[model samples]
Target: MAEPVLAAELRQEAPIPLDLGFALHPGEVTALFGASGAGKTTVLRCLAGLYRPRTGRIRCGGETWFDSDADLWLPSHRRRIGLVFQDYALFPHMTAEANVAAALGHLPRAQRAARARALLALVHLQDFASRRPAELSGGQRQRVAVARALAREPEVLLLDEPFSALDRAVRVALYAEIEALRARLACPIVLVTHDFEEVARLADRVLVLEDGRIIAEGDVGAISARADLPIIAAAAEAGSVLDATLVETLAARRLSVLDTAAGRLVAPVIDAAPGARLRVRIPARDVILADRAPEGLSVHNALAGTVAAVEPRAGGLADLLVAVGAARLRAQVTEDAVSRLGLAPGRPVVALVKSVAVTRPGA
Candidate 1:
């Protein structure tokens, strides 16, 4: 684990002064996650010298950027912090190369152009370096911003919703570019996002915040299991995003049992058993409601439960969230069917699912 290159204690006032503290080390990506006003941006702004806390200290590597009590405060420019914004924020009138060159203004013109070219090439936009922001696509403009931010080669990188404006495919490709950049750079990255899926894809660790306070922090795997995580993401994607441990291998029958929220679910042929955690996705659409426990059904994972909530899904589909054991399993059924089955907030129901469908993630 690389030591943090960035550190801070946050405060926005009142009951939760956001007395939060977190650090980032070389090559580590720390995701700042929370609701709209959880102070995620405030934390980033403070680090960027845009927002100053009444009481807090910030350090990058061995240099102390700010010490409120000690009266040490470095102005924004002196901190050497690179920023990537939600909007690409490239100069529309200038060519990509010029925009990138501007970021290296402190350097001589020739050296600045050389660095800009290198940064563009790093983002695979070398050929488009001369094009103005207006001539480029959304993704292209974003790459220019990234190149510009890197042109300065700061000690730390702070990105506030960098992928927000782009389409999914574009955002994903850009995020991959960032991950590659993360591998090559030594600077600690503080990425603020409201999307857990993005966090799962990009962050090494997550800082879960609410109401300008740090409520929880952990790896993506642990936080995905939280009941609320799924609601942010769709029920289909939420469940539990696990790396899946392989505990046992049943060679004779070519099957394995996975210890999951559905309890010891027997999975297909695998080299895991008992203690191994298997990656599985229980789609809300795949889960079905039953009135009673059938003796021998086609489905294997059956959970006896009571209807927790019956909510509307798009296109007349309804989500029947049932509380099974210690976890809530979501099933999508027609609203009419729910009405016909007399399924309501407190009605008894069984969640049925096929084990074969619970394959490995992306499998």
Candidate 2:
């Protein structure tokens, strides 16, 4: 394994004013996640030898690519990196194959074409080699761009919104394609995108940025584990979020488990051995409350919890926060239901959840 294509700490002012830090290790995907002006693209450009950070050291695969203190900077073309821009940056006058072949600078024309053909084939575009950029769809053009980047056998791969120019379905499918490529290529990979969904789908580790400096950094679970208060208040959904440990298989073979905060509870059986992680957020509106524990009900898991707080919602619906030991939950229910159930702060009630509501990733 080699070091990252570039490793450096950047200090900048603009979209966000401050010193920002990041590192890209070989064989790992690092995502610069932020909003429109969060400086994600700026960071990518700096790593690609485009934007020069006033104070930082950058190296590519153990080779010094850029050193600000040493007054040594390499041009983007000399960096031996594959950069896929948001627009694909294909030469419209040339066919897809030519655009890819152009990256093989010193190779003979025929050898370059063969290298281009193989790279294009890797991206599933062998037949489209002759197609000009104008003749290709957005997705096809992006694939051509990827093929061109790989043509150099880059020591590092940098992508800026590679999927943003395509349709949703195409973006998702292409992401999987890129993920497959990532596994096969041993180079360091860096992607810049504001779309958290993209990060969730593709990133092994996510770095959250706000106001230029990194506010959070960790795997998906760590970032999402924070109470939705700040993010939820921003997202506009009311739900009690819980992280559970998978317990065991039930007789019915439906998913059974212990709620993160509440004690033992079972839902429909899930396909997992003991000790799998599940993240579930139960919406407040789904929970039905009764003064006395309901008996002989269809709901499998009912836990007693006290009302934590009440939040006013649209259309006379109330968002209730219930506390089960340390487990906090948000449920959306009608004010009438709140009144009928005699629910208030500190009132005891049962929280009902279906097994299917538990969300799982392909772990």
Candidate 3:
């Protein structure tokens, strides 16, 4: 494995106990997800030098950004970190180009304008360079903020709920734009979001936090498969994220077939071509459990599997971890259904999933 580009261990005294450590690698988008007071943003701020922890150490590309024992701390302006805030903090008086140029103030005055325009163009805001913050749309303003952040060519990018203010369609479009931007930048990106769907679509790795501590950390697929995480077990929208390769496109049926470890599954038509790998999220609520080989059903996908574990969840529901040929899937069934079907560990069963319910995240 490659060494992490950003590494930190942070601790705090009050308001919510903070004792957590994590690392971010280059060319990777790591998401911080949790409840409001779970210390997700705290970690981001700590890394950006906005919030200094009582005792901790932070390193970026082998350079020390903070070390409590050594009495070393880099100020926010000194730290080569780019931050995009939830509120698009653009200067109303300055045009989009000027805002981006502001970040390159350290450079020579004559070179700043060209660098600013280049950064704006990089974020697809070339034409909007002269527009003020008020004249631009929410998504456009956010893009300008992103360009400003990149103007410094920071070692790490910090995004704190940057898209929460936008509508779903705008957010989705920006997600695609950010993905394209990631391909051009080599720095590690840290995103703080409460939306699991956003995490599924954009994050390569996930960190689940609770009570100011990181309870689980892994790739999106593994982390979303975890039954122990409260967010997965308790949320009605809980689901397992799967990484599958597109094998075929059925234009007649308007569906796309993906090859997963469990089996071949068909979903609504995806925009990508065959042989492309993408993330699919199967909502637990949409999954149906069958005790016998299901026959005559409208569902398009059914995979034979064994029940690995079952746990009673909040709201009188139960979460099942089903193992299907080395791939684990989660199904949310009722306690009544579990008892009537005699569901338990080591029991043979089948998992039925609706084609429409299978979400092609970030599509």
TM-score of each: 0.70, 0.71, 0.94
Q: Among all windows of ten consecutive residues in candidate 3, which has the lowest summed lDDT?
A: 354-363
- Candidate 1 residues lying further than 4 Å off, grouped into runs, are 14-17, 228-236, 244-363
lDDT of 2 by residue, 184-252 (tens): 988878888776556555665667666667777865534433333343333333444456777777766
lDDT of 3 at 347: 91
For each of the candidates, the C-alpha root-mean-square deviation to the true structure, in angstroms, is 6.8, 5.6, 1.9
lDDT of each: 0.75, 0.73, 0.87
Candidate scoring better on lDDT of 1 and 2: 1
Kindly indicate the candidate among 1 and 3 with the higher TM-score: 3
The residue-by-residue lDDT of candidate 3 on 204-304, one tens digit each, is 99998887788999988788788877775665478888888889899999989988766788898888878887788888888899987677888888889
Q: Per TM-score, what order, best first?
A: 3, 2, 1
- Clashes per prediction? 9, 10, 0
The parts of candidate 3 lying over 4 Å away from their true place are: 314-316, 356-363
lDDT of 2 at 234: 34
What's the residue-level lDDT of 244 in candidate 2? 71
Position 316, candidate 2: lDDT: 91
Alpha carbon RMSD to native, model 2? 5.6
